[model samples]
Target: MDWNSFWEGSKDLSTFALAIRAIILYIALIIATRLMGHRQVGILSGHNYLVAAGIVSLAAIRMLNPESSLTSGIVIVFVYAFVNIFLSYLDIKWPKTIDRKPTILMKDGIIHRKNMLDCHVTIDNLLGQLRLKGAHNLSEIDTIVLEPYGKISVIKKPEALPLTRKQMNLPPKMVALPTILIYDGKIDEKNLHAIGLDHEWLMTKLREKGIANPKDIFLAMLESDGTVYISI
Candidate 1:
């Protein structure tokens, strides 16, 4: 039904059917969540994500028409919110009974291809996640675990955890984040200007590096130490 029918039509008739629909759908959803077990109880997990989409869609569908059911849509939406809260509580109370444990994606610096495939995680996803977790060197990583909520936990090798400046009793140098001047062959004029550098200065640096065009550089960063790091 269209939206015009929802607000303009007989509110009494729509409300009657909507109440029945909401009650039935709500009960059925609760039952489905229970039968599905831990799979659907995950906080923001795939199942929960799908459930949210489906429930929201159903509530929206009931809202578009039948003036009587218009108010039912609001009730259904709030009901779903409470259901999600209930599922979250169940997940916490029972733990594994309603959620799977974190999966090991890699161990001993070796990627578990089979486990990765089973977990539906691709190598690109693994490496990208690892990089975000500061595991730049796979060889220096002891283990990589894929958390249930999609966190990538990394265990670095012993040698990788070298003595820090604090341990050595040495003064730490000021940390300066490198300004990205170019990325994917495109120049970032705003960042360049923010760093007090202009297009001419960038061109000069590129010329010194034997690069005739900024488009040839895939990534270019201007360091605080007056150095330009380029990756083509």
Candidate 2:
């Protein structure tokens, strides 16, 4: 085979074919990433970032290699997909291995220097987050947690002279997050099953609200306190 002629022929393939391959690869990567879960995106730890980089790099290589058959590119995509799926299953089954260690930045109002060193976190980062949280001073904090997602969670210590409940004047309890049963006129069966209800129950609820079909409702929610709200 003449290598130069082969390269020339490969370059001569229709632009539409190249565009379609790019689109297909993009869609596959998106689906695979979503299947991996949102934690993969939020917690860009060293390991997680490496995994994401590897996936993108592989896809880009396959996209540029026009000489490689489409079937070969798809096979590579599926291989990565399968590996991700298997790892995700293992993580769910044995969470301890995949679970991240909690970095204790503070305990009993004292900073844990050892933990900070291990996690490579500096006092400046911690103080910056604290300031964002409206903490005027470190002395006001009782405890602080450096969450796996790189967020600093702070709790204020109770004052030496405790205030009465009435004096504190705490706000009323906020309502729980609404459960979306239907989105964009489609019944979310997985969400329904998660909340221990089925399609029949959903239909019955809709009928009571004068909605004959799930498609007629633009949004449907079930609050934790057993309140059902629907919008058409």
In candidate 1, which residue ranges exceed 4 Å CA deviation? 1-43, 55-68, 169-232
Q: What TM-score would you give candidate 1 relative to the actual structure?
A: 0.50
- Clash tally, candidates in order: 5, 0
Candidate 2 residues 125-209, lDDT tens each? 8888988988868887888888765777888888733576557797655566778998879988888998789888988988888
Across 97-133, the per-residue lDDT of candidate 1 in tens digits comes to: 7766789887887888998999899988988998787
TM-scores across all candidates? Answer: 0.50, 0.58
> Where in model 2 is the C-alpha error above 4 Å?
1-9, 41-48, 64-70, 160-232
lDDT of 1 at 26: 63
For candidate 2, what is the total of clashing residue pairs?
A: 0
Cα error of candidate 1 at position 29, Å = 18
Pick out the ten consecutive residues of candidate 1 with the lowest summed lDDT.
Answer: 1-10
Identify the leading candidate in terms of TM-score: 2
Instruction: Assess candidate 2 and give its lDDT.
Output: 0.73
